[model samples]
Target: MRLSLNPLAFGTAFALALCTSAALIGSGPAAACEGRTTLAQSYVGANKDVKAEYVYCANDLRSDVSTSTGAGSDIFARQNDVCGAACTTYCWTPSGGGPDPNDCTVIQDALLYDSENTGPLFSLDPATNTSMIVMTYNTCQTYILDQTNSSLTYCRSDWATLVNYIAFNCQATQNAHGGVCVADDQRWYIQVQHS
Candidate 1:
């Protein structure tokens, strides 16, 4: 498996933290049944060894629902919108510099925890304050955003790792104004199953 996370490795500290704060999420989706709008639901999360008929519920048929996958904040949220039964699940080392938030997914567990991220690997420059590197089958080699002007060059990993797992390619030329990167036309998408 490309990703292996043994909860034991997180040690007692992380566990204690999770135990102390996961009260809200522990209740899960069942608790929201009071006013839920689910319509003939099958299931939410995916299994490690299963790839059944990936369902697709339309916008008019569903609501913009979400669920938490980790501790209190800044972790990850599963978006269950236009996911066509949409959900993006991810589990890995809590690294600061990784793929774009929107690009990271775990819908097909095999693509994430089962493999070493088989797609365009884009990560913020870990060594610098401003920069992101892109790698894939596509031509865009990098996102050299260390200077005032940097563009997000795209990549297409042949193993079906498309941007948002859908786009063939993309670009977000942005400038670090006041030491913060700014791309007027770029944004991140986060969709996860509330299972």
Candidate 2:
């Protein structure tokens, strides 16, 4: 007799494997439903874990999505639109700065002179700020807004640590422009207009 199993069994196994990989990739506290769009889909965030993946359903596929990692809100809305099945992921770390002397000042000067107008890593609203920028010099961090005291803050432990790293290594003056940190809580959030 030949050993042949039902096709359904193979399909189920495949699905389970995919789910397992997705889970390993860092989904949210909840697992995503089969074929359903959700925030828990694999994706990357502004975290120190370089192996992290920023995955999610397409904007056309899902109106909401997020991940366990802490990424920038400025990027999240765009991620929904372009996060392929596997999602966009990358590894990044700051380097090449002095030991001290003028840490924040060095970074602030770079921001003002670099022509990029980088950002303010700190925030006035902790609840809203989820990401922090890297500092190039002594690396003392600051913010355009101070989220260290906000109500909507949802950043995770690792995320908070990452932000702290940015703050300590960057400049407070940089926080005066378009690049402000927004805290992500592993849950999909909708963009709200400011008054």
Tell how far residue 170 is off in model 1, in angstroms.
39
Question: Model 1, 16-84: lDDT tens per residue?
Answer: 232222111111111111222222222212243323121212222111221222311232121111111
Model 1 whole-model lDDT (C-alpha atoms): 0.22
Least accurate stretch of 10 residues (summed lDDT) in model 1?
175-184
Off by over 4 Å in 2: 1-76, 79-101, 116-134, 139-195
Question: Model 1 Cα displacement at 113 (Å)?
Answer: 4.3
**Model 1, residue pairs in steric clash:** 2-115, 56-84, 78-191, 78-192, 79-191, 79-192, 83-86
User: Which tens-of-lDDT digit does each residue in 1-195 have in candidate 2?
Assistant: 899987434533442332222111111232221232222212112321111111222222111233223443545433332110111111112222312324433433343333223232212122323222223222233222111222222212222222223333222222211111222332222110111
**Candidate 1: TM-score?**
0.18
Estimate every model's Cα lDDT from 0 to 1.
0.22, 0.25
Error of 2 at 5 (Å): 74
